[model samples]
Target: MEETKDVRLALYETIMNLVDAGIHAIDEEGRTMIYNQKMRDIERMDSREVLHKKLEDVFRFRSSEESTLLKALKTGEESHLVKQTYFNNKGREITSVNHTYPFYYKEKLMGAVEIAEDITKIERLIRRNHEPHTGYTFHHIIGKSKAVSEVIEFAKRAARTSSYVLIIGETGTGKELFAQSIHYESERSRGPFITQNCAALPDNLIESILFGTKKGAFTGAVDRAGLFEQADGGTLLLDEINALNIHLQAKLLRVLQEKKVKRIGGTQEKPVDVRVIATMNETPYEAIANHRLRKDLYYRLGVVTLLIPPLRDRLEDLPLLTRHFIQKYNTLFQMNVRGITPEVLTFFHSYRWPGNIRELEHIIEAAMNVMLDEDMIELRHLPMQYRQSGHYTPAAEKSPLLKDRLFEYEKQCILEALEANGSNISKAAEQLGLSRQSLQYRMKRLGI
Candidate 1:
């Protein structure tokens, strides 16, 4: 038997009949070397079905941000109680509480150990507590801006109260993070934090989901708790509250006023004690002007209002936000990138970032993957459209933001220097009759 087989056998003996869920071990190359029997059962695989398969193959639904195993293998840091989900061969999905730690051999990278605790029961409760506005893991939050700091501080305060709270911002801003954080910090931290996307559900389904249904209440009805009752003694986040239709809005207004709900087929009204946090991606004034929102409901939910600033207004936070996403994908892809070069950083700084923090993250992740061992991502590493520093092309007018056109001129200069010097920056500087210091200065200014 191979060394891994021996290790797996040893691990099995150590964990025989332990009801703490499953355990898995992976090597530096992401190959599984050892796994407990419960893991096999949960994955619906035999003990020896897959002795050396890649982790990516087994856990197909891993989060896009980062994987626990990858981070431990690369950084040797222990992941403390991260959460994840997996599906068995029988197509039964399960939630887990994960812990990852690096395993070493002679101080060198060797393998990693994973312990996952089944949280299906806890997840059900969590789903309820995660009322449409429950708190989020730190990973989902994207900014380190001073303005964001203010939002976090105020949210902590609002969470302590049972009064209604409203969040207003442009689309793509991270309002959900605030909503979730509030619930987590509140008195019901251990309770369910449930959420319902008011706009995503149809009118008939909306009422059913929020107020729930009696057994045989409607078509294919099953006795169920709605978001309000399910989130009893906790919180609920109603996203895009303005998108709620008029009829349903009236029912929602009652819940806000009376703090009670009656299931569709139930006779009696049940009192509820659920905090409501509503979010809108548009300003209240704008929604009012468009007649998309009900002013009375808005005022009731606006007892404590929070405004999330757009990414454009907080450009200083760009570098930190970029670094966060880079670290995330680095672990995800098993890439060991030290850092982004000044050239790449410059390109990001000058750009308008129309999609805000979200767009910046996507761009960085894309550029990193396209270029290998790229210590300094140059203009060439960027999308062709962004390589030209804001210069006017036939397509300039149709571009999305002001920053795109500005980079065009910088791209031209960098290209001219590289070409004249046979792609050598020093030689290019000499050809341009510029001291290398002057050339470097220009590059920094232009973000080339």
Candidate 2:
């Protein structure tokens, strides 16, 4: 019993230490009980300095209620993905998104646990007030389908003028690529080209980041130019513009109309010669109907709208995309992979690529990793998850034949066995009551 308890404790400690997010828990008395390695990294604190110390001693918050853990402990509440900025014991400002929860034993409040994902680096990068650059151009985009060709033509036309352009497409459909292509193609190509994703920063911080902040605007505010000022005489790419709040959208519209911006706490308006290009992962009408976006702002921004087609809608270009990715990986991996098999191509067409072009590239990369001494990518070389997904059914088959069903069942059983045995062929074969060679043969036959 004692040995079992020791093993459990060790397992618990290992799991906590291995997690990506910071884990900080305190007792009801506000003394630290658990502070994992990730938490130490995020706060730049040593275990000796924090463990068994009072929460208030190791960190500084404006008020007790400002501390998510303390607030949860006192109010018995849970908060998720709440953005917080506070000072550590060493006076370093740290920003993070925290999920806090209260724990109880027999209806009595015991303590609180907080999982924090540090975003201090991201905040610092945005505040650096440096001009951003994009290497992608029209030549970088790879597609030959009519849908792709039409969008490219429209984007080039949008590039010729200084009008605002809005790009609409699903995630991973290369919306940003088009934005960059348009920027580089425009006459403002010589000036700065800055890009910001509206969904990345918190609401309270994004306003200051968009419009310049005065030194006395807030506690840590510095006199800095925002993206609009930074992109003067150039292009500003606001990716996922719909993610901005309605109030911010209105401000953006005003900036576009007047070609000027007022700092968050400044009196004077500064003129900016910036061509704005925005992108969204959702349809404009749906976003407006849901009140996530303003219709008037949409009209002002979408002076030249470009809708990029998803990969599934343009499967005719899959062959070109496949060849491009294959060549890319061949150079990166230093392998002489010729191309994918016709069977794999058939499966590609049948699969509904929800992730679009990005997913296809990833699939090809994964297959190449396991392709040993093979010039062509085969079905067995594909990722295990892709093979297991029902999307791998042949495009010609409306209903799976009996042979196909049996093959799928055998492949599933083998996959399960391999997974259970940590992908060890000998161990998996033993579990399946077969010799290793026999199992290998079966796996090859089933295209696992």
lDDT of each: 0.73, 0.85
Model 1 misplacement above 4 A? 1-144, 384-448
Give the per-residue lDDT digits (tens) of candidate 1, residues 1-448: 6999999977767865464567888998989887777777656677555569877765556466466787798888988567777664456677776778999899998989888776554456446544344246444566667877777777778877887899887676778777887778778877777777888757887788889889767534557788898888877889999898867877898788888899999988999999899998766655756877765576567767787877766767777787787788889988866667787766666666556666767777777778777665566766767777562123222323323332453356567767777778788766554457866876786776
Provide TM-scores for the models: 0.57, 0.64
The RMSD (Cα, Å) of candidate 1 is 23.6
Tens digits of per-residue lDDT for model 2, 1-448: 9999999999999999999889999999999999999999999989999889998888898663389999999999999767788998899999988889998999999999999988798677675535456458998999888888999998998889998898988889999899889888889888887888899888877887788888767644557788899899988889899999899998988898788999987889999999999988877656876998776676567667787888877889899999999999999999999998998988899987879999999999999998889999999999998888676644443433323443555577679889999999999876765568878988897888
For model 2 the TM-score comes to 0.64
Best by TM-score: 2
